[model samples]
Target: MIRDDHQAGPTLTSPRSNGARISLAHGGGGQLTDELIGGLVLPRLGNGLLNELLDSAVLPLDAQHRLALTIDAYVVTPWRFAGGDIGRLAVSGTVNDLSVAGAKPLGLALSMILAEGLPQRDLDVVLASVAQASSEAGVPVVTGDTKVVGHGQADGIYLITAGVGVVPTDRRLHPDSIKAGDALIINGPIGEHGLTVMLAREMPEIDSVLRSDVAPLNHLINRVMTRHGGGVHFMRDATRSGLAGLAADLAKQSGRHITLDEAVIPVRPEARHAADMLGLDPLEVANEGKVVIVADRNQADQIVATMREHELGKQACVIGWVGDDGDGICELNTLIGGRRIIQKPYGEQLPRIC
Candidate 1:
């Protein structure tokens, strides 16, 4: 649906929009494209850096320091769903990457690939949601581009966001810092975000109420960083591939095998119910606003406490520890006293997940 002004993404696809479905005109730089950007994109995402609208952004760089940058592309199916939509998911995904790396998010550059026959109103709604997410994250949409493809040349729409952030002072967080005794801490419940989309789209027959944990973790990260910056060995958000991949990466790269407690790992009741019905491994699903943190054993409790203070981290727990297995794999200690090897998922269980 089209509107004189841009509305949020979820609002765009509702029956009330003045325009139905999108068209090539929305991507053209003329009036329709102008409406798409001005009416929708700008209002939600515009800020000091973005409003400049120059070919490039000029900024002063700090001396003797490196910057952290991350880019994420959102192609989640059914763009709008329970909890969060693609627009907000894209923003949060990019920002969370920076946050887990001990960085303060600075700005985002958005690119939209529009399929022909898509509605102008739909573009407006999507852009507006992107804008709102960036605004909430305190990041500006500094620059962007739009391209239209042939009908069926693309899925409904695709969004790409590149983000930059500043790392903390005197922080040496890296996989190398993880020691054999460091505790593995998760910053929230395991499977909400992954199951939310799966159930929303009726994928894989997982049928309980669930939603994606798409949110900004900057504040939670900051709180934990404040108390344990030096003690933090590493941080990573579990996304398209969840904890197993993250755990395995830390295991191989840091030369520390990871051990996780099955019973202690947090999972929501809805997700648990759904997982039982579908015979799915929740660890294989995606999460937009969660992190796997490595902290010194002495500081693990403190880190968990700091995280729980933030709403995003209410279920934070130390579910594992660094161990000495040479295989560099993430091993789970099941509730039934059995051990299983956790590896990166072989293929896409759910595609189009940001």
Candidate 2:
């Protein structure tokens, strides 16, 4: 545990950088990954409208205000991981992406790629899982396409999904508004999805049943938008590129810095132990069901309580706060009282773990 700085709020001590790189760890959905996206990728292609990091982008209309859109692909190895399958993953990934953008998912456009010799029953199982996940996620599969390849041409299966949602005029979200001194919150434990899939792929000898965190976070989004004034500054699913990569993106867009207390950062003991054995930092691991939010401290308590009201946020915490570091840097104030720059992840640590 880190010494409490809940009072002084640790000062930002990280060096600032603009370069960002993609790494295997970037795919883990932890802190390193967040930095990569936050620092590098988003600055080049996105604007304020694209920065909210919500499940889907919410557009305020002078008159038109009914549709939201997002597209995503899943090429996760071991198509069938502990918690979900490719089909379900494809659907939920798209749905959550749209959801985080401040949209309520309504329909999906799906596509699948398969290899020869793959069992039809396995495909059936995956499709069934997709249907079930869509139901649970409150979205529908409205259309799709499929393709097949020879035995060596494909890696079992790949899937892509496009989703559309409706945005209410009342809900307004933007990432640029993510000001200094804002509170940073996580909806649940981090790294579970990435680690679970890794456990299945690399260490099946370990008896623990790890599951993917591939569920839609729309309902949770609904609860938040309905309860709060939708004063949310930013929102993002901890996906390809972990929390670090995502935070880096936040820092870049808002033109400020973020200081996270290592102790307050939440990670399950099981995940921590597994990551230790694998020489992985839970911060850079991937997660599907989790989200990172930057909002006002006054609203942090209410947001956390609303999150806990849902099944996903029982471990929700105000892990850190946005600060006036002013150079787009993110720092981790160690439990031992040291501070370090959160560099972009380098090589692949857990490839295909997503």
Who wins the lDDT comparison? 2
Model 1: how far residue 304 lies from native, Å = 0.6
Q: What TM-score, to 2 decimals, does candidate 2 have?
A: 0.84
Across 128-243, the per-residue lDDT of candidate 1 in tens digits comes to: 88888787787888988899999989988889888887764466566667888899999888767767777777763544567778888887888888878888988888776577
Tens digits of per-residue lDDT, candidate 2, 1-354, equal 111221122122231453333456555444454455555545565465444444465555456465777887788888887788788778877888887767778899989898998999989998998899899887989999999999999899888899888776655556567787899999877888888888888888897745677787888878887787455776888776577767765665566788888888888888888888788888877788888878888899999999999987788889888887678778889989999877546546678864
Candidate 1 Cα errors over 4 Å, as ranges? 1-61, 203-208
Name the regions of candidate 2 deviating beyond 4 angstroms.
Answer: 1-66
Candidate 1, overall lDDT?
A: 0.73
At residue 145, give the lDDT of candidate 1: 83
Q: What local lDDT score does residue 230 receive in model 2, on the 0 to 100 scale?
A: 57
Clashes of each: 12, 37
